[model samples]
Target: MAGGGGGGRSLEETPTWAVAVVCFVLVAISIVIEHIIHLIGKWLKSKNKSALYESLEKIKAELMLLGFISLLLTVGQSPISNICVSEKIGNSWHPCSKQKEEDAIKGEEIPDDSSEQHRRRLLMEAAGGSVRRMLAAGGEDKCAAKGKVPFVSADGIHQLHIFIFVLAVFHVLYCISTLALGRAKMRSWKSWENETKTAEYQFAHDPERFRFTRETSFGRRHLSFWTKNPVLLWIVCFFRQFVRSVPKVDYLTLRHGFIAAHLAPQSHQKFDFRNYIKRSLEEDFKVVVGISPPIWFLAVLFLLFNTHGWYSYLWLPFIPLIVILLVGTKLQVIITKMGLRISERGEVVKGVPVVQLGDHLFWFNRPRLILFLINFVLFQNAFQLAFFAWTWYEFGLKSCYHDHTEDIVIRITMGVLIQILCSYVTLPLYALVTQVIN
Candidate 1:
């Protein structure tokens, strides 16, 4: 089969080995960067800068993953573009034609009447019979006659790869440096837990320290003014409260709470932190094992539907997955609420320690759950791309002769834009809803 047309330009092929080598190099560099960040964290710890160290670690973890994702997007573009513009004809695959004129110029042998009719029948079936009307519409087919490919050319793709690579590198460096500089300037802003007094008390005792004045740095003068202004201060307070109203599950906070509850049983008993942590981890591992089967089953089911030309019915598989996540979230919330109640009463519930019960909750299995969520997101993205490619091949390519290239391009563009919007906007909104529900 032939590839999409740009003066007979074939699909830009990337060697499998080259892609593998690039991925390996990216992983190696990420590992090195992480090690450097770890060393900086240790130095911060020695300087008693616990807040800054934790922030650094968090930044490192997030930026490293984002950098890897950016690199993967750059490296995978060519291969994904090739898949988008190619079609399978019978047992063989060929590049799609950009224009009907190119098909005539290629001087391909004409099939017998019956064979030609069969091919037309196949094309019509593939296109769900939409091609006939598209062909009959003369002036409306001008956009299709242009035969523009769905995405950019090879050179443009290469330039995009370079741009993404540079942007990823710059983003990582800029964020890390900004965090370090900001933390350095706020050296006295220790973690709340480490302070001997409350934030309000500290502010009341030394208002000058917290106040913004003419001597304040240029970057912070506006922030100082906002704090000094009555209206702006109310707005800031409202915004802060609004942000705090959002539910957030912090793993470290949960773990520390569990540990404190467990150790509260004996005031004089020597607490073995390492042993307790090890036991908690073992229990959490068992919970993860117990939950793995259903998650894996749903994933496999989705994969089957996705690969078997059941694109239209793909949403069916996600139903069970969503149900599982919701049920798990509810169970987690119930367990946490119960634990908090027991802690507040200072009594054991049914002789089960809060720590032991917490270990079995979804909160402890968060890392595994996050991993699964990432996999699900990747699968969703793959499904979106596959569905788009299938539609382009079946609908767009079949109607190519009708000069419907503009329609094809528009459909492809819309599909891509929707995929991005769903990934970033829709998915996050869904997650927020789930969080709110929990």
Candidate 2:
């Protein structure tokens, strides 16, 4: 797909429609692929059944589903951008193009004072400023912007409140599901351990009461099970620690650790095998970088409180903050888990080489950190470049000059400098803070 292009050369420049098309096509392709996989799996079972083959079928199903959703978002980016801009424009009136053009011609004739342009700008900013202040003061839930009605109903006055309610519901569901599963596994393991101990006691203290004989064949399998299931034991230990053993700050790390361990295959020997790799990556990232709904809350707060001279620009700062925090948190979660040997291989038992907390700071363990940081920085810069350029081209430069510019140097230079400072300087500093704080 063609990239979303620079500031307003054409409506096509944004690729809004193209993005929608791509998203639709991706979803269709994914559905077709899913059906094909199911058909192939059925054919395999008819030809020759194997437990391994069945497992492969299941893994493939999961991986393709994940890829489908990921690509769906990639193509849906334009819609996301549209939503941002549309929300900003709200419902306020803009001057007719004819009137604007006449005004521009008259202003050019006078050229001494550009007061008309200044009034238009000041009016827009004033309206925007009031909206921002209201939002900041807990009036966001009841914003009175004259632009588009934010809520579906004309009478609605709680758009922000509705957004929060929906988001809180989803977050609560995810946390409950993960923790509940963890607790269930712990209970199962404890029950099994208790039964084993009871059997052992019967054999020792009441030899005549219970007949027991050890079998060599089963011993080999039990040893294998022991190696694989120690991670289960680790799960119990970690869950206990999480609920009762650790401080709140450390819980995020431990939560991620538990997730990584849980995601690791039960069959340790082939844990890193290709069939499982996709799952491992997805689950790992979800724990690491997934944004909480609260981020929007912060975004709203930024927009509301900082409405002074281009103060709405303050909200722009938080975009990088949110992105970096997500990335840094993900990195820390993955690094912490990998160091603990909580990868596809389940968990490490005694003597199995695993990086400790201190060992993780080494460059050797964190080559990915550098790569991720570089890519993240570049991507942020690119986004700012595209977004600001689009906005400026749409309304600023053309409107100022009636679509003509004898010297665009100042405008272009200022735009580039703003992009540079916002993307490179401000974003990287915020990321550093996230790394240290997280």
- Local distance difference test, each candidate: 0.37, 0.35
Candidate 1 per-residue lDDT, tens place, 387-419, comes to 344444433454332134553454345434433
| Residue lDDT tens for model 2, 1-438 | 011212224445657887789899999987896688678668757865343244444445434443454455446533432232234454233222334434533444233575543433323223322232222222332324443323221111122223233333333333333323333323322332343235453343232232111121112212233234545534443333223232222322332233234445222322322223223322322332233234334434543443223333434434554444344334333333433342333332222222223324434656345434433433333333333343353336544322335224433444344334323332222222123222
**lDDT winner among the candidates?**
1
Every model's TM-score: 0.30, 0.26
Clashes of each: 14, 6
Evaluate residue 239 in candidate 2 and report its C-alpha lDDT on the 0 to 100 scale. 35
lDDT of 1 at 132: 19
Q: Report lDDT (Cα) of residue 87, candidate 1.
A: 22
